[model samples]
Target: MENKTPIIALVDDDKVFQLTASRTIKAAQLTDKILQFENGEDALVFLKNHASDSETLPDYIFLDINMPYVDGWMFLEDYSLFKTKLSKPIEIYMVSSSIDPRDVDRARNNENVRQYIIKPVTREKFIELLGKAAA
Candidate 1:
């Protein structure tokens, strides 16, 4: 869906980080819808409704694990509920500053996840991931 164009979403509570990342994505000339959500619940709601009929369910989703309303794990669980519900695979990456081994393991083992990235994701890093996906 989404007119076959890439959709990039940033799910983070920090205003500074959100702004920085948004700017980075824009400056890179990736040129896509840079959607932002303060919490996982909000992102999940949009995903469940609008993206269900759409195909490009976030070509790249940067998800922050620590949030008040719904953490990243909770979001992942909520997202998993949509089994066979959509046409596109909403690729996800666990983006956070948490160093807890458990969180890393969980993200690594999750079937829907692509990778676990640290906070303040650099533009170069995201571009690298984008290259991987493109390749």
Candidate 2:
């Protein structure tokens, strides 16, 4: 029997965070492919390009609030407009190093956001998230 792995998308400008998160996900045996984008613009482009294909759409998205072009908030705004056209539902999680109460409140208030996580996502968190995703 072949095990199917989930596709995870990481939208962040921090190269170190991407690398660390990718490694952590792999180490946790959560996912094999971690599609990375340096900014929300690139991630949005990818999503738009694959909107019609459910097989190509990401199962999970880890979005950072800050970036050079098209921050997470902007992406969310645009995504709200584009989501209705998509073939599948994407589970989005707001991940950032920011500990600001405003950010947490904002993420919590967003209907599309599943959860808010701090940076350096741990293996345990990945396992928990993966379990939830499977459910």
Candidate 3:
């Protein structure tokens, strides 16, 4: 078997969060490839287009709950429909600023979501999550 660097996707509408999180991931040296999407729709399209391409498919996705279009829940709904077609398994983490219990509980209930993370994820946390995925 060959070791392959994991690819990460950041799906969020917040530009600041995207920039900061990407920088943090880079600083942690988690992955050299990072995909950015402004909303779930875009992420979904990307995933669909690359469903059979393991090299292009992301190993992990950091999803935001709120966005202009296709929020995290909506994304998960659609993703579940076609996830089996994907060439590789992708771990999804719900990363949101909303600390609402309802939001957390809803995400936790979703089968596709591996974890629900609060906003402003620390570099160490990113390392831990990505490291686990890579492992």
Candidate 4:
């Protein structure tokens, strides 16, 4: 059996958010590795480059809607092209601070999006998400 720890990717530009989210995920024992990306572009690059490698690709991606460049929307558009190329199925959760109903509707309409979560993701939320993913 393959002994690979699940990998989680946080695609956001906020430094403080990344730090806190990483800490919470670690504290919650969600996964062994957490990959941080400053923008969606970087995350997409890594995913594309490692599309054929299940062990190298992230199992889950928490995407933020706003950023300097290649925001979550753009990332979703681009990712749609390469989604089928991935060797492993990756669960994507659109995590944003926006309370806009449009944003929520858009995320929910997307077939690839597993769920949309608000900001300041709590340890309990992490547990629920991770547990559901495992199931």
Which candidate gets the maximum TM-score versus the true structure? 3
Residues 10-86 of candidate 2: C-alpha lDDT, one tens digit per residue: 99999999998899999887888889999999999999999999778898999999899799999999999899888
Which pairs of residues collide in model 1?
1-55, 1-56
Q: What lDDT does the true structure give each of the candidates?
A: 0.83, 0.90, 0.94, 0.93
Weakest 10 consecutive residues of candidate 2 by summed lDDT? 1-10
Pairs that collide in candidate 4 are none
Query: Per-residue alpha-carbon lDDT of model 4 for 1-135, expressed as tens digits?
Result: 564567999999999889999999988877759999999999999999999998889999999999878999999999999899999899999999998999999999988899999998998998999888887
lDDT of 3 by residue, 1-135 (tens): 687778899999999999999999998888779999999999999999999999999989999999987998999999999999999999999999999999999999999999999989999999888887667
* Of candidates 3 and 2, the better by TM-score: 3
Tens digits of per-residue lDDT for model 1, 41-121: 999888877766655467778899999899899998988888358667667988999989999999999988899998878
Q: Give all TM-scores, in the order shown.
A: 0.90, 0.95, 0.97, 0.96
- Model 1, residue 96: C-alpha shift (Å): 0.4
Quickly count the clashes in candidate 4: 0
The prediction achieving the highest lDDT against the true structure is 3
Provide the RMSD of all predictions against the true structure, rounded to 1 decimal.
2.3, 1.8, 0.8, 1.3
Count backbone overlaps in model 3. Answer: 0
Q: What lDDT is reached at residue 74 by model 3?
A: 93
Q: How much does candidate 3 score in TM-score? A: 0.97
The CA lDDT at 113 in model 4 is 92
Residue ranges of candidate 1 with Cα displaced over 4 Å:
1-4
